[model samples]
Target: MHDTEALQAKFFWFSPGDMTDVRQFFAPGRVNLIGEHIDYNGGHVFPAALTRGVSLWVRPRADGVVRFFSVDFPETIEARVDELEFRPSDGYANYTKGVIKAVQEEAGTLFCGGDFFYMSNLANGAGLSSSAAVEVVTAAAVRALMAYPLDNARIAVLSQRAENDFVGVNCGIMDQFAVAMGKAGHAIFLDCQTLAYEWVPVTLGDYALVITNTNERRGLADSKYNERRSECEAALRRIQEILPDIQNLTQISIDRWDDVETHLASEPNLLRRARHVVFEEHRTNEAVRVLKAGRLAAFGQLMNDSHVSLRDDYEVTGPALDALAEAAWSFSGCLGSRMTGAGFGGCTVSLVRRAAIPEFEEHVRVAYADKTGLQPSFYVSEIGDGVHEQQKEGLEV
Candidate 1:
């Protein structure tokens, strides 16, 4: 556990220069541990909260204005408490606005106004979910300060809606859900369709989760992401006509894959998209079994197969993501590696031994840079807590 003093030091961006008695605060961010681009299709994802997240210190105000400042971006934004709107040009406002819009619509009305001091260090597009983290953290902070009682699941859904509507991005609930509802030292196995989840313990007594950026741009991320969703919907539409009981591709049994060929043949692209979702869901279930048995090597191999399926079958992984995963598989220390996130360009999550940290980092760093000319960034992280409060009386411990 982080001592109060250490936590307070991390909140240096929130200077208490003149004001006092304000205590309620929160810090949370987007996390991508193993699954990527799978949630929208009702596929499983494994993500843990980051030790580094967005910190938001807030206190209610008398006026109906929610004034906020970001320590990370260094900016101030003011919005009417009841009038939550998105600005196309306001980059930072996207998150705050999305949160407010989601909460207000869900809650029917908001109660109070407040100013927030937001601070975060997770870089966006690293496939770490900085934006989703900010949105969730801000929404949570707002609710706490306003004395609103809302469930974390509700908060997650609201934040997701905000991202989809206000931010104009078709984001899945995994990022927001993982940040708001993560547990330490465990990987979350979430049923996207059911929202049912279990904390699958990742007992890496001698290993670690090493993430390396492929340094490729998330080209067609929004486009392909939406396209896949559409394809799934189209498949569901066709399948539903024949089997009215069928909901999403998640409901389709693996054996049923061969049974429903003609309809799938009508739309080759939709067939491909639907195929991945059906198979990946089972992979997630089997992954849990392997992980429970402490079969890191097998689990790692599954990660490799997943990448190949994602690259060849799902058609999301790019050359850089492929190379990054291939390079990690070559390393003796790496148990398994695969491209994480929406994957045009992002980081690859790999299982590595703790004792092999130095050599593993060095080998992948040089190999990736030499091949792509893009210096790969590395982040060494462990599973961290979900949303938490830092009160002034406690000195933010």
Candidate 2:
């Protein structure tokens, strides 16, 4: 509620008098530490849910209209329980629309009209998957409300569909799935192809995950994220044609990479995209092993290597991300750092020592601004719960 209180009052447009039954809410944040552009290639991704999420304050509605407001944004959006409209082009609004459409498509439940409100502290496009958090929490609330199906995996899939078909981003399922189903103090090693996952305990001795905004101007959904996904699909299709056996990019071996490389030669960009996905899957597994062995510095170097590959081979990272990672590696207190999101500017995730966080912040802050003329936003996060609720005392009509 500390974070929720910071959103807005106007978007709600509802008085305490109109409040009804209080319901639970939930959402998740994603840390794409490495393994970028790999999920669509049937690669394994290692993502952790940050100590950030979106929550809902929802109750029953009697008037047949489901009115809503974003506690985070400063505007109100209203739609009938019967007539929820889809704003396909808007990034933020579609998150809400996606929840409704996905749940409704699966169970076809009605809200019976409720006034819904939400709040999130997760920074948008900070490579944090704030959008997926909203979708998951909102969808969970609806599922509880209508007494519809309650499957976490199905909920995750529906959330992805909303982002893909309704929102039109063609995103993978990692963001929604991780946030919807996460455990505190653990990272999930997810195989995107098999929908299988194992918990990797993240015991960062005397350290925490530090996320810094590069503030690089880049459109996430439009930043060639889909083009990379498409290219991987093409490579997979071509490999399938020749071998008639390799089903996913994850199946290609180092010996077979020669075969894969030949097909990608004509399209350098696509080839680079394939290189990131294929190589990233390997890094994800190694990072898991290194962390398990309690070697923080070792794991940190892997993060550095992954960033370099994303920067040079994948071509997703730009100068700002590069500078941030470079500066982090130079500092003694910094363990590892790399661009975190859809690259070409957004945020960098760094592993930093607890005793050195302050100095680390000061060094990177000034260095990034001096190098790029852009001020970066720093966030300190721990592993947090998905979504929950509490009873409220308020006025009612």
Stretches of candidate 2 off by over 4 Å are 1-12, 15-20, 88-91, 390-397
Query: Lowest-lDDT window of 10 residues in candidate 2?
Result: 3-12
Model 1: CA > 4 A from native: 1-19, 106-108, 393-397
Clashing pairs in 2: 26-137, 28-179, 61-113
Residue lDDT tens for model 2, 58-142:
7666776766676556666677766766764343766777678677778756666666776667666667888888888777777
TM-score of 2: 0.91
TM-scores of the candidates in the order shown:
0.90, 0.91
Over the stretch 109-171, how does candidate 1's per-residue lDDT look in tens digits?
A: 764777666666666677777777788788887777656788777788888888888888888
Query: Where does the lowest 10-residue lDDT sum fall in candidate 1?
Result: 10-19
Q: What is the C-alpha lDDT of each candidate?
A: 0.76, 0.76
RMSD of each candidate relative to the true structure: 3.4, 2.9
